[model samples]
Target chain A: MSRKKGFWRSSVWSLSLLAVLAGCGSNAASDSNGAAGGTATNAAGSDSEKEPVVLKLTTWNPISQTVVDKFQEKYPYITIEHDKVYDQFREIIRTRIVSKSDMDMLWLFPNQVAEFSKEDVLMDITGSPWLDNYLEAAVKLGTVDGKTYGVPYNSQPIVMFYNKTLFGELGLEIPQTWDELLAVSEQIKGSGTAPMVIGSKDGWATQFITTAQFGLYQHDNPDVFAQVASGEKKWTDPEFSTYFDGMKELADKGYLLENSVGLSYDQVAQVFKEGKAAMWPMGEWGYSENFDADFSAFELGAFPIPVNRGDQPLVTSLVSDNLLVGVSWSKHQEEIKLFMEFVADPEIAKIWSDETKQAVTVKGGTSETYSPLASSLQPLVDASEAQIFPSMTSSIEPVMFPIFQQILLKQDVDTSKLLEQLQAAQNKDI
Target chain B: MKFMNFRNYIMFILPALLIYLLFFAGPIFSGLYYGFTDWNGFSFKADWVGLENFREAFRDPLLLTALKNMLILSVVVIVLQHSFSILLAVLLDQKLKGIVWMRAVIFFPVILNTVVIGYVWSYMYAPMVGFLPKFFDAIGLHGLAALDWLGDPSLAIYAIALVMVWQYTGYSMMIYLAGLQSVSGEIYEAASIDGAGPWNKFWRVTLPLLIPSVIVNTVLSVIGCMKMFEHVFIMTQGGPANSTQTFGIMIYQYAFKTSQMGYGTAMAMILSVMILAVTYVQIKLLSRMEVAN
Candidate 1:
């Protein structure tokens, strides 16, 4: 009887041990699967090519289902699982990347591309044939250390969208220089309308005026930020402080919308739509079909934010938007490549541009259909000597938002001190 | 026989023990280890930098601002939330018409998700188009209507604290109500017979009996407010010049946004210690009061 009881006890212990081992084994397998570039079922010896693959593409920006459908229709073997993360996108993406999650592709911001490239979380797509179709400058945005990690899908130029009806009523013409812009703003303020509406409460919106000015600055000092990084120049120098001076002048003179610091981006958009402000400084993407439907009551016109004091030609900031990058750990590299190539096609780019109302980066990808405002902005987009604004780069971008917010919010803000702070932040990062 | 029982007990609890060690204890230990290293979120390698992150955190002005904001939020929430909950509990404990519905109505917000509450309050606190502003405008208080509740740095944290109080007062009230109900009728009757007025009876009898509930509520509120993230994140995103940034949001910004996971983890470890110390003192003081009662 004792021997039989001991045998039963040993059997129970063996089964429990096996159970625990199985649990641990499964976890290890799943973890290794991500690092080893294999799917869960691939461990079972199935041919990966014959198996239908679902590639997970995560983005924070809006994407069209039509584009996804078209991509899927062309490649029947691959399915794109579009995951949209609305809030805390960068944080989520960072966590996902760190964990070696099964993310096939991602839409990265320029700074994110720069930061992620340093960690080798993104695939180097240098010398890809499809990249030849994009504008060289746009393609250069995703390149760091002479290797491309992302492909720019759209070019967003920060332009001033003026209330045409309001300008007409006030007999104001498009400002061609900084002095003329200030005069127009003063006149608009005199006419009992807010000169400009900026959603400074959302820190990112504070970049519009500064970025526009920096574009003109960069036109002269193309290597200004690089110099700052190398300790040859300071952010407090007139080259950078001049931009803040212009932005501060607008705030100090009461030319901005009342309580502009309190208004959110969406609220400011609505205020501009209601003709409460004379000009709304935003990216060209703001002139979408939804904006058209809501803002149909009044006509709108676009102009580059004039940043020159004299006869210096106008230049506006062009930022690369909707950058598609391949995850380094993705098992479906070929499928991700195919998808990227498909997007690089001019026809596909045109469809995306039309759907998003943003300019595509692909050569010959200009949409045939354009709104009147977009049409008016196209010449500026085409002819303006635009560059990625200095503050938009990865090293200096983080401090820009808070410093710009301080400029807008604090009446007696020490511009020199704020610039010093920016320099200090850049120094720390370096 | 005892050894056999012991073996059976170990066999039964081994699975649970392994799970707890793996999931709960494992992360905490790893986090503690990471706190001493310089682990950017992207890189797998973490170099040891003993006491450096903590030293830097002390000098970080933004961390100081976040700490200040967190303390102010905690004090405001603890005082106001407890006072209002105790008041509501006392009132609802009285014999009143439709009291059940009133209790349910009051408790409804407690059941709602924090994110839902945050978004709803964001709409309510929005400047022009929000319900509060419109209501104030309708009541002819245009000045109040024009106040930017979430955007103004001075007012944003307080506004979020108010939302926290609104969502959680009902939960605290429920606990107080339970404490109130557990008290025998004879105690109140005896106080009444001793010629004690309503105020005296509440102070001497009801309030003393509610000491346990107050302790529970205070500890929970302190911990919850210390870790406040959702409302501030969803509403202002610590904006308008980092006015509403809390310690939790600061950690998140460093850990994920800036890729300084080690520094963020160090700050989190400091916050955890602070919370533990504060909670310990609170419980000790409250428990003494309970013992006195």
Candidate 2:
């Protein structure tokens, strides 16, 4: 019995020691890999050419397989492993960074550039030659503190997708001003059809409405967001509150889809596709081939959300999407740069634009085969200005979504109080 | 022999203890450490902010709203789940045809993945095209049909709580069933001989004896509901104006979404303390009740 007990005790202790050693061994291995990566970054060009490299690209956005195949064909030594993480993308990326995972490239949003760069997770690509090929506004989206960290991929403006068949049936021409929009909405509502679909349940969807208003607001006061950030202006001021009030008016007048707060973004698209509503306020991706909805049931037409300015051509609010950034810790810096140059190529950008149906940020990258629905928005896109909403660039962006949701959900919501909440969130962030 | 047995016992538990210390205890202690700092998650520079995060958390209207919602959900889940579970346990405990199959049917939802259940309930509660609204419309109850189950700010949390009860009541029922099975049949016979009616016997004998099960069920339900995330996250994402937001969702939003890891950790520590304190008081009171009964 003593011998048996001794054996058991020895075995258990040995197993525990093994577990500890295994953990330490893995850590040591990780440390060595990190050291190697750091060295390789300094000695990249020559070392990268001879040694075959596999780059790990992580993105929440869908990348075209054809684009990947073309890139691989051009650079045979470089193998790209694309990992798509849709749900909890930011959280997962943060975890990967903390774990020192070998993520070579990342598809990020423009809003995330400052935050990620501040964390020192992004590689500075300010001096990259291919950056000159992008539009000035596109390049500016990924630049923080006068240093570029990401390559802007697409310029997707939030536009209104109206059922052309329904619009024709209702005798509603595209509204050019806010008042005109309200009048058209009222007419559509009077005909027993919901005027618009806003998926307030998915809180982020509410940004489309709010950002459109901000887009118009920024046209006149370009430094409005900067003033708000610096405490020169308050969110509760009429300058900001009026836009929210505009949003509330649409809800108050029963113009938006009933029970829209119950619908997801995809569900609202489905609602629009089913002809349940006259207009769907969403990003340009809604009409793209990548969109889940089948719009064959109705003639789809899109227009920029009408600003208050009547005669002046509408300045569409263009938001940069799929901003590709190199992970700072990646071993294959040369390979990542090569991929960046490939994406920046106008021909490759055109292929990407054609496949994804987004307006690529590369100069001369717009696809010629745009459908009439996509083609209609070209004038607005040409006159578009990228406006950074103060809330989106700040830490208060998450809270802004809920505030927008509250405005849409509650008919009698106090816009001043909601804006006060925004001010408070901003103060806390500061 | 006693010394040898003690050594052997320590050895047996050594591996598990090492793992527990390494993973669970280590992370918790590290989390507590981080709670005192202003760590923005990705940055290695974490300046110590003392109790600032916790102090701000108290003033945070969103955190207060989340706490209120969590408490309401906990109470609703506990009451509804326990009542349904006790009733079902009693009903199914009786010797009847297909009682085993009936128990299995009741327990089926408990076995289903929470994500699957959340999605299923979401579809069922979805507006305009959902089963509940369509069913109500078909039955000539247009008013109920028009009611947005998961949308209306006043109704969303309760709607989620209903799903919680539906999924977890069976789990609680099994516990009560086990307690029922353990109760000797002779005790009921004695009660009957003493001229006790069904309700009298249940009140004086069955329920009091089932105190252990009640304690177990209540504690589990309270903790489970306090940590409610997957259901609310999957269904409404604490949306339609932050109505269904709980501590769990708020913690996640702060930690990951807003990049306030230190503040999120502080919130988490507060939640853990709250859970521990609540559970402690509950066990104390319930254990006293058990002893008295």
Candidate 3:
């Protein structure tokens, strides 16, 4: 009886061990399959026996996905994957570029393109026949040291976005000059309607409005300002005070909302939506979401930011937010350029522009169908003489951004203090 | 039988040791090495930068601001969280109806994700739309109270700390409650028999016994607050000027945002050192109090 019991016990233990091994084997296979499945599902253009050419595009905007989807329908053999990452996409792409990883087609702004070109990371696209298609100013923005590094896909001119209802209630006219704009703001403020709302909370939003005011003068003499930045001219020149003091004077006069220092642009936009503010300085795309009936209460209009000392109105715009097809380290250069040319075709451009409600850079597309807000912004686009402004981030020399933020926040920061700080920052090396 | 004993020991300890080696010790050692190189985090190649990254960290203005904010936040959250928690635990220790339900309600915030808690509090602090400020306005206390809780530089850090206190006070309270229950009722009974008042019994008997609990709670609070990152990032992104920026945000921006990977890693190393030093000081002080008690 004892022998039989021991034999049964040994058999039971062996069976359990076999079961455990089987379980472990299956689990390991399942985990491997899970990781493989993720890659397989995301693999582009693997629809049939033929593997399609895959192109990857990265942007912080989700709208890029819509553009990619439209492009993919026309070229079923080519798959476009748009990677949307907020706040971290630029860093990730920069690291990949520096590391020589497979990065194809990035939506880099003009300033960023300039900085990257300086670092020898961007491809020179100047000789491409596609250069004839874009507006000259748009083309110029993408060029650094006379070499084209990217394609201009979209333009967002910093126009004066005003509330028609508030303007009418306050019995005010659209300001045509810097002094007129300030006078109207004062009048509107007297009527207890917030004359202007610029959200300084994000700090960058403040830069947008302040940059536009600076543009009125800067665009007239880009060479002089560019020289100042290059240290050929003093940054403390009185023109610098004229630029900084304009924003300071507005803030000191309480032309902005009481809580302007703390409110975000979204919150400031809400004030306009709620009919609390008379005007907001923003880009053309700011009103894109007003398609919802709830936000249609206010009529939107864009005017060139009132001229300070120039006959022409100049606007600060980044090159349009569009996808640029860069040759990936792994991709065949000829095939990538061919794909980019196909997407830039006028017919395809027409479809994209009509659907997205933004201008397309293709030479022979219809410009008549733009939204009402886009229509008003056309004059600023046509009269836009300047190529690009110094992006506080892209140019590493001066971290002018934080200096700008400090000026906006400290209301009492003296001009001399500002110039000393800017000069010091501007001299710092990357 | 000797071989079987060896196999049993391996079966018991091998998995845990392997996990600890892979997850804990491995990454820390890797991070330390990376701190010395100009590695962009994706490539096989990197340049040796010596102590250049450290030199940059010392010069970064934003890093200094972030360090200051982190230090202030750590001190405020640790002290306030423990004090409120002990008070609540003491109150709940007294026998009362619905005390169990009250305890659960208090503990609810502790179980919540920091991200959710941070966002919900941001809405509550939202100037025009937030209910908190609006409620104050309704009560005719607008001038005295309707400050933009997260927007104003002077007030933003306090707002972040208040949310942290709300979330973790319940956790600290539970620890104190457990410590309270462990103290014998016999001592309290004897004090009552000797005609000692309730306050006198709490001061002489309960307070001394709770010393160990206070030490545990204080140390944990200090460590957790020192490493705070997620809530601050989600709430303000260190905005309105770098007012709410902390050491974690500074390190993350340098590492990821600016592509100064080496510099960022160096900042992170400094932060870890700060946390270690603060924790050591706290433990030393608390241990002294423990010995005295």
Candidate 4:
């Protein structure tokens, strides 16, 4: 063959192969895109007669699969496809809009709802029947500009989880004073168990400590948010430094699990679960998971994270559960409302409360079906003293985590300089 | 092969050229445009604010901090990675007993995924049950061991850069080995007859002959360090006060986490320009060296 003809023939073959490969990709995408505009309604309806509707719900929380199964059972016409996007929930759901994706529902916590609300991405579930059943705090979180956008699921109070067996063995009571807590930690460290397990490697886990510690001073100063808004209260204050100082003290005394910086949240949980550490600092959200584990000799208990002295008011930080947001762009609003209504039913809410080991906002959600660890904090939560977590999640978390890591690692960190840097980091306009 | 008609030539190259333009140039220009807007990533309705995002990025202290960290990572990685690779390539060029074992051992980390390598080093550098601290104390070198390899701001960048060096040195050694083998045996024989010793021959002959490989390896290492993110993300997360943060991590943080699409795009433009400038200089310098030698 002539050179020109050979080149032409080869190019055609190569281009054809590329075309075929590209076709395959497009075909696969369209097949998976069959998640919307398929909700069937029974206009000639009786109580039990309806066609099946597929609703896709994306979540970051590791929701129990059985809750979804039960929902499907109640509305036999509805099939819920649950996608656990994990840490990428926000990015994925947000981008789903660009693709004109068929996502119906999503779970968002705290700031995410507010962020998404700015874009008008979520449906305004105003006067949603489920709203009345929810706690006012949860309703407020999911609301922006007087319109409700989400339904609250469960709320968890962050606390210090202790091994009762270990505490009893060391002849220690739950220390109500910072000095007593230090002494207890010292004694525990001397006995060879690491006083606490806090994994700073993930950086986000350090916020658990910050939020919990901030609770020590939160009850007396419930209006700290106003101070923060007015720029009157800086994280570098001596009062705040006491928390950092406590972390430094733990690191200096080798009371922290020596390699906690390298461990992840789950790894530290395991260390505490295996009775290698005296306490695990975390929220009650993990109560069911941790308590279900093989702790042969010990029972899990919790207490308020102490502040300074015994006389000072003791408190804990309660972080409400993230709200379930409905996508405004979805074609399945009926199915979305149906699923949420099922969730708000008292029996179903109680089941969610039991499974998540967190207090549900449904009026009769708290029916005393909590694990011993969660029950310990229920009274404090009911008393309304457990204020919202004071730590700044957005502006401060990125910079503060590192400073907290250094303090907990016994490094010579200048809180003054670091807090200044954090303030500078927050000062950047997006 | 034969020459084609001009129309056929255009048709043949059109597919590949269009693919390149559609994927590569399209995104680059789009990102440049996004840099001038106030986009929150989630919203496509961007309010165009001319140069505001760039100005904000310029004033941001963390960007400067991350830029400094990227430079240090690039310098340290380029030096150690190339030196160690060259030494290994030269030594392994000599056929000795157990050469396969030594090469395999050195190249083992190269085959492992970077995520695995990062996690392994994290565990090794951990204060408890970590190999470094315990091994150091065992060898009476306790001062050299750190309790938290990633928690110390002063040491975190260097520590992460060294991990990159450890992982890629073997790959560079393989490239240098290929370059070394291409040099004829006659050149070394001629050097020996001229009364040149091994050290002198290496500096005079082996080094000069390996210019092509040096250029390739240096370019790769420079690009790798300039965009270093995964290791920092997996290990320190640019922490102990963002000491180990890099340009790539900053782009991801602003774009994805912070939802500041315009700010991230501005930083991304800066990083792309910086990479382009560095690569251009490197090509120019290497071409000069190639011509000089």
Off by over 4 Å in 4: A1-51, A98-100, A177-197, A213-263, A270-277, A285-292, A296-300, A308-313, A355-359, A366-372, A375-384, A388-393, A409-430, B1-4, B94-105, B134-146
Query: Tens digits of per-residue lDDT for model 2 on B152-252?
Result: 98999999999999999889999999999999999999999999999998899989999999999999888988888999999988887888889999898
- Tell me the tens digit of each residue's lDDT in model 4 across B1-293: 23347757777687787678766887788888889997878775888999888888788777778878878987898889999999999999988999988988998889998888888888777654567877987988867664566665677788898899999999999999999999999999999999999999999999999999999999988888888888988887777556778888888888877778888999888888889999999989997998899
DockQ of candidate 4 compared with the true complex: 0.28
lDDT of 2: 0.81
Which whole-number lDDT from 0 to 100 does residue B102 have in model 1?
95
Q: Report iRMS (Å) of candidate 3.
A: 6.7
lDDT of 1 by residue, A201-300 (tens): 6677778887787667667777676567667877777767675888888888888887657667777787788788889888776666337555576888
Task: For candidate 1, list the clashing residue pairs, or say none.
Answer: none
> Would you estimate the TM-scores of all the predictions?
0.92, 0.92, 0.82, 0.84
> What 10-residue stretch in candidate 2 chain B is worst by lDDT?
B14-23
For model 4, residues A1-430, the per-residue Cα lDDT tens digits are: 5866977787787788667755643442353333244333442375366666678988777665667889888778778998888565656765775454667888876666766777766777899777788777567667666878886677777778888888888798887667887899989988988888887777777766555666666566755643553467665566655556666666777878764665666656766777778987777765665456565657778876665455665666667656788876666677888788888888888877776656776778855865665555666555535555532435455666777777776677765676666556554421
Candidate no. 2 TM-score: 0.92
In model 1, what lDDT does residue A172 have?
Answer: 89
| 10 residues in a row with least lDDT, candidate 3 chain A | A390-399
Residue B123 accuracy (lDDT) in model 3:
67
What is the C-alpha DockQ of each candidate?
Answer: 0.48, 0.58, 0.29, 0.28
lDDT of 2 at B226: 85
The per-residue C-alpha lDDT of model 4 at residue A343 equals: 85
Model 3 C-alpha lDDT per residue in residues A232-254, reported as the tens digit of each score: 76657766665567667777787
